[model samples]
Target: MSTIVRVAARGDGVAEDGRHAPFAAPGDTLTEAGEIIPGPHHQPPPCRHFPQCGGCQLQHLDDESYAAFVADRIATALAAQSIDAPLRPTALSPPRTRRRATLHAERGLVGFTAEGSHAIVDMRECHVLHPALFALVAPLRALLQRLRPKGRAELHLTLADQGVDLLIRGRLPDGLAAAEALTGFAQAHALARIAVDDGYGPETRWEPQPVAVTFAGTPVPLPPAAFLQATAEGEAALVAAVREAAEGAATIADLFAGLGTFALALPGRVYAGEGARDALLALKAAAALARRPVVTEHRDLFRRPLTTAELDRFDAIVLDPPRAGAREQVAQLAASKVARLAYVSCNPSSFARDTATLCEGGWRLDWVQPVGQFRWSTHVELAAALSR
Candidate 1:
């Protein structure tokens, strides 16, 4: 008999001896034959799509097991680099908390892609999307049917402060006829804004008022398709962790800052550096409006990370990088004289790798906060504090 000990990184359950069992959860029992016996941690999935949706894989596991899986992923990555730190209990956003999602449309169906296939799930029900976002599905389907689109298209939905922001890709919205259709759709839905792109770039179709995203109690212009944290609760959790790490610093540097998520929130002179022009401009405008002491810079950190000598000017540093992680920047930071460092990451493996670089430079992990932003999915996020 093989006992499933825990869930692996890709949503598979691992046996005590490290064998693989598909769709098995922790505490499950397997017999001599290849069969997954239900376990205490396993439960019926709530969403009708379940394994077919590809939006969520761990829906079969209960809350405890799911949260455990999130923490274990971070631990496993840290252990790879011989790093250990006390981790807070995983903070999980509840179902229907997702504020941003990309849905595929094909064969007159609109929803998430089918598991391991290009086929569309045609979402009649979704437990992952916010109710407001989900409510747009039926209307979207009707619009697509009426248009009779020739091929594949993608829909990106984001909940801005004003209302839902919709961006459609892979369809031609040219001509007076198509323009009228989109205008009617936007007005009917009372959407905050609608954008259409045909492999070139997003062009705004309709926007009545300026759409913005309130971060850390300040309203910042929400640039079209700008990067945003997926869930509101998840963003709050990460912000809290960042604040704790950044406490007591009179001057803090926010590396890779996106629209001042932390720069505007941190209570000090903030130096925000980002590569995207629009994001930098938005952060600058918000900082000016808030009258905060925030200095903005347009920098490509990947190509030109701040040097060690340049880094020593700040008391603390906060960097929230993309999935590829900030290896180059971490290397420079490792050799810097900066005292406190807070890192917010979406990829554990990359975070662990970069952390090893910092540890090698005599830095130590202070603490870790594991976050499950996208619930029931294998994706994991974390915020960590480090010191010399």
Candidate 2:
């Protein structure tokens, strides 16, 4: 018998002898004949679709083991770069708190795709999605049955400030009846907005009022398919970590500032830079309306990252790059004279690579805060504070 000691980055459990097993939690015992015996850290999956649905991967792990998995992901990545930093306790978002999700629909089935396959899981119950968002699953299944959309359709659901915002990507029958059916569905659910895409871009079908999402006490217009933090609690955790890292800084620069998640939350003046024009415009408009001292710039850091001299103007910097991490931007930041930096990332491997660059340039990693926003999944997010 072999004991599983840890969870890998791809959701597989690694045994003490380095063998891997799927759906096995830490402390689980694996027999030579390939049977897994549940252990102390293993728990019965809460959702019926546990191993089938690709929505979550670690549902079999208890809270303690799950938190360790999140931290281990970061620690392993940093170890690969020969870097060490104080790791704070992991912040985990509770179940049913996910405010945004993308589901797939085909034929009459509507749900997440099956694990390692393109087939839909036909979600009858989801433990990860917020109640408001999950409530629409059955209704969406019904709607898809009526529409009988050819091929696969994508459903993007988000809980906006007003109510649920829905976007459907598939061909729909064009007629007054189809339009009325969509309108009636939106009205019945009090949806903030509903749009459809038949190949061309999304076109709004029902929207009595403009849809928006509130960030840092300010409401910003929500663009169709705009990126948002998965869960509200997860967003709060990341924002709080950034705020703490940037404390006492009168001037800050927020890079990859999507919808002002950190720009509006931080104190003092802020320079917000983003690559998405629509998102930047929404942030600029929100700042103007709130009378916040935020300057917005539409810039692609990948091609034209802020120079060392440009980065030196700010007392602190906040970077929230995508999963690829900010290699080009970190090059400038490493050589800059900025007093402090808060780095938020969703990919530990890429983040560790950037950290190596920063450390090579004389930056010292102070601490890291791991956030398990995409709970029960191998996906991990983190916020780190660094200084010269």
Q: Using TM-score, give the best candidate's number.
A: 2
* Residues 1-388 of candidate 1: C-alpha lDDT, one tens digit per residue: 8899999999999998778888899999877686889899999999889899889989989999999999999999999988899999999999999999999887679999877888888899998899889999999988877776668888999999989999988775457887898889999989999988877888888999988999878999988778889999999999999999999999999999989989988998999999999999999998899888999999999999999998999999998999999999999999999989999999999999999999999899999999998999999999999999
Clashes counted in candidate 2 amount to 0
Model 2 weakest 10-residue run by lDDT: 143-152
Clashes of 1: 0
Estimate, for each residue in 1-34, the C-alpha lDDT of model 2 and write its tens digit.
9999999989888998888998899999989887
Best by lDDT: 2
Using Cα atoms with residue i matched to residue i, what is each candidate's TM-score against the true structure? 0.98, 0.98
Alpha-carbon deviation at 272 in model 1, angstroms? 0.7
| lDDT of candidate model 2 versus the reference | 0.94
